[model samples]
Target chain A: MDEKVLLTGNIAAAEGALYAGCRHYFGYPITPQSDVVEYFSAKLPQMGGEFVQSESECTSINMLYGAAACGIRAMTSTSSPGFSLMQEGISHIAAAELPCVIMHVQRGGPGSGSTQTAQMDYNQVVKGGGHGEYRLIVLAPDSVQEIFDFVQLGFYLAEKYRNPALVLTDAIIGQMKEDVELRTIDFGPTPEDRSWALKIHRSPKGKSANVHSAVGIVGIYNEWLARTNEKYENIKRDEVRFQSMFMEDAELAIVAYGSSGRAAKGACKLAREEGLKVGVLRPITLWPFPQPQIEELASRVKKILVVEDNLGQMVEDVRGAVEGRAEVHFMGVFSRHMPDCNGMIFPDTILEEVKKLL
Target chain B: MSGEDERKLICDTPDCINNTLLPTCPGCLHGVVARCVCEAIDDLGIQENAIGVVGVGCHAMTAGAVEVDTISTAHGRAPGVATGIKRAYYGEAIVFTFQGDGDLGAIGLGDVLNAVNRGEKLTTIFFNNAGYGNTGGQMGPTTIEGQVTTTSPYGRDPAQSGFPLHMAEMMASLRGCAYSARVGINNLKNYAGARKAVKAAFQKQMDNIGYGFVEFLCTCPPGWKKKPDEAFHWMEKAMMEEYQLGEFKNVDEIT
Candidate 1:
């Protein structure tokens, strides 16, 4: 059973790492989420896990690359610019089909943007965020409890599919304090299972001839890409996770994720009080996003408003899934002239748009 | 050198291709250096525990040949990658990065320095062939004195280009590395030294002593626009002047 306790979103994520059997934590300390490192540094070794203060974000993710290659669960957590440095390594893992988890608690920016929170990296996270044809199983957990649960589920899906996984939160979710249950889930693989990892070629059973190489060359990569593409298709077709509130026969379907998801709840509730016949679809897993369901809902609802911090990134995905079945309006406060990271898209800003659209 | 001396050296003759794959240009010096690393891994009987971090440049092609657990890293960050791999699974595998001059010296200087300074328990093999061959020929950070390439059209202007960097020696100054040595791929004496460095790097990794480095000052005849024999002769006389061979640091002796 998960015990109810208050935690900063960063600490909640650290606890999730422990519960999920992810014993290796490799990352450099960055702002707005340093408590994750601080919490895991003390807690991991206590549980006989390994925690490393790597030289940089690049080294941390690459370290995850090594650990995950051996089929062991591994992860790294970072903020904006550090996440930027980690993209190259993330690309390598994605190509290799190595299962590693990354948490990006977005602060603001194109450079060393800000230590404060914002949901600006939706495009970077959901669209592979690196070079080549790849996608992470991006999970958006709005609540502190969901943050803990998805960190574990993210590891399971990553290992099952042999792909990189992501838990995306902004400062809002990463730093929030709320009651969460610390339930133990038996993930069934210890860090010791990765004996060969990057160093040796061994399955848990013992000595076996290992192939260090994976998809990179043309013929080989094509075969792997075919397999990866199938997996991508499966995720889109099979996994469509979301939470619904008053969605039945709703005339307006408001879609959001992460902080916006929380904000949309309030918006939908207000619209309901006014009897405007509105409902909300808040996606828990952001990638292979809940598109088909949104399409189904779009047929009944006249308009779908995509409320996000950045300018209309996810609206395109919603529009593509619906394919002109209905009109999709974007309630985005996009400060394109300034920069993606520094702008603000307040919950009220989205609420005001909802008022006008209805 | 006589034919008898050539027999003793471990060269990458076409007769000696073991795997159906390899990681260097046809007849480039990197083939010899790679074979030495392979031999060291074989001799230690750690192929099962070996992870090779292949980087861009000539070594990018090496990802296919290496039999051990391998991951191709971005340019110049092989050491950083290997450091993570090895540390997260201590005693589980032998981790090393294989890199060339353009990838290591030109663009990725920070990665090497930081890895060395951190004393990460890993091995690094640097193939320092003076000019860039993967792309169009250009003067690399380890380009020899008075050498001509695509970038330096009128021969390397030492007055403007400055002398080449002696990387192992520079790394030795950090005082955190376990072993540091520079060798060559041109001849028997230099080949032996290079192999010895390769072996030492592996041994240090097994011992958990600390960071280790082996620099192979190789030759690129096709890019340099010369016959293989002439390239070796050039490396013999002047390459040594700019980038010296022999041990820069021996941590075992200190301990």
Candidate 2:
């Protein structure tokens, strides 16, 4: 059995990446996610891996692009503003069809909103934050163990489809400590064909391999777009992951993810104790969001409460998924235990909203 | 004799370049610089192990002609990208960035400087065509004082628009930089010097010395509103006067 070690969300992510064979880590330090860079700096070099403390998030993401182009496992981690700086690079990486992992430990934001935990980056991560039509495989992990597990999963999916994968968490999980099992997951064999990657030696194809963002010719671009769209569709069809708790005979459902999902679990228990038939639907894959399940749940449940740490972002997706089949409500930053940047949404507070809804 | 035999080859194209690919502009020296880079790679016998990171602008077209495995990066971010490739290869592969004035001097200045400061084992080939040729003659960081570009219709004024950035000198000033030189391909004498400078820059990386930089003073005919020949003459007289051509720094080892 793999040994279980107490670890913070950030350390788990770093260890997860190392175990997944990610040898190159390029990142800039930002609040709520700096521990990731610190851990990699101290440990990666010792493991004969590369760690670059980039000047900014922009540089870091571009570096990730270059490393990924070489068909190697590489990643970077950042918070809100830093992630915003990475949008352009992400778009380019997506366009080039290179595989890489990015960990966004979300914080409060419109600008530099707060260093504390928040789910404000839901729209940016799920929807295409970068320019052009592109999608990231976004994973939201609620606990340190899940963070550890999902990071390895993120790398697997990224390489499997040759697309960027995002591990989306928040400051609460990033800073909190929990037991995490440290082990290398068997994601099957690595992709056999890497002819597309930049070669250390000349390719057997007798032509130089090139990776560029722009497909300048129109017809080629259309074909590339068709291929990319189909890939995204395949990802959507096969990669939707979520956890349904007490959903068997519930009339009301709580839709949440990441830290908010953890809080909702507690809320569901309290609601059950008070004789309310409430359940929690926690989405693990935020991009190929469990839309089908949400639509199915909307058919069964009369009301769905979308809980998030921000001012209603993922609720839009939930509402769209329900498509007016059921009434959708929202509980956000205002429902936090305290009314400040460091405030958290407690289970009791979520239960109060659950009671008010029913 | 057959037509092929009748036509004696005066000069052979480097094996690392696809000679069928043409330059983006009539008077642009990007093709010349590309050929020189290919020749350096061939001379170093590292064509298979060379990776070029190209930045956005007219210079980006050079990547299409060069045969080395290349990654076209966002504007001005080639240095950062090359740094990653070099580190990932663990100094086993040759890594270099091909960038333009606006890319290396203005938008990506911080990335370039930081990479150099980090003593990254990489090479940078900067094309200074005075203005942004791909964007239709907009003023750039390397545009000479009093140069009239589309953005500076009334000629660049040092008071309003700052002085032209001397990148070779700036790189030389950095402790991490091992080699820095500025050269031009306007004339045969300068063209020879430019080729040598390019080769030396790549050699610096091959020896794992430190950051190496070579700035090429190129011409943009349409951007400067000059005929091809006139542009060459103008570059020799005007551009050379503003930006002196020669090696600014060379070190046996970086301390």
Candidate that scores best on lDDT: 2
What is candidate 1's local distance difference test score? Answer: 0.77
Q: Spell out the clash pairs found in candidate 2.
A: none
A31-139 in candidate 2: lDDT tens per residue? 9889899999999889999999999999999999989999999999999999999999999999999999999999989898888888998999999999999999999
Error of 1 at A103 (Å): 0.3
Model 1: docking quality category: acceptable
In terms of lDDT, model 2 sits at 0.91
On residues B1-255, what C-alpha lDDT tens digit does candidate 1 reach at each position?
667756765544321124645545545777677677777766677766777777778766654455655677677777766766765675467888888888888777887888777777788888887888888678988887677889888878779898787889887887668888998867777677787888897788788877789998777777777788887777777787778788988786323
Off by over 4 Å in 2: A203-205, A217-219, B1-8
Looking at model 2, residue A21 earns an lDDT score of 89
Best candidate according to TM-score: 2
Which ten contiguous residues of candidate 2 chain A have the minimum total lDDT? A214-223
Residue A19 CA displacement from its true place in model 2, Å: 0.8
lDDT of 2 at A114: 87
Candidates' C-alpha lDDT: 0.77, 0.91
TM-score for chain B considered on its own, for each of the candidates: 0.87, 0.96
Q: Which stretches of candidate 1 lie over 4 Å from their true place?
A: A186-219, A334-352, B1-17, B21-27, B60-67, B158-162, B253-255
Q: Score the docking of each candidate (DockQ).
A: 0.38, 0.73
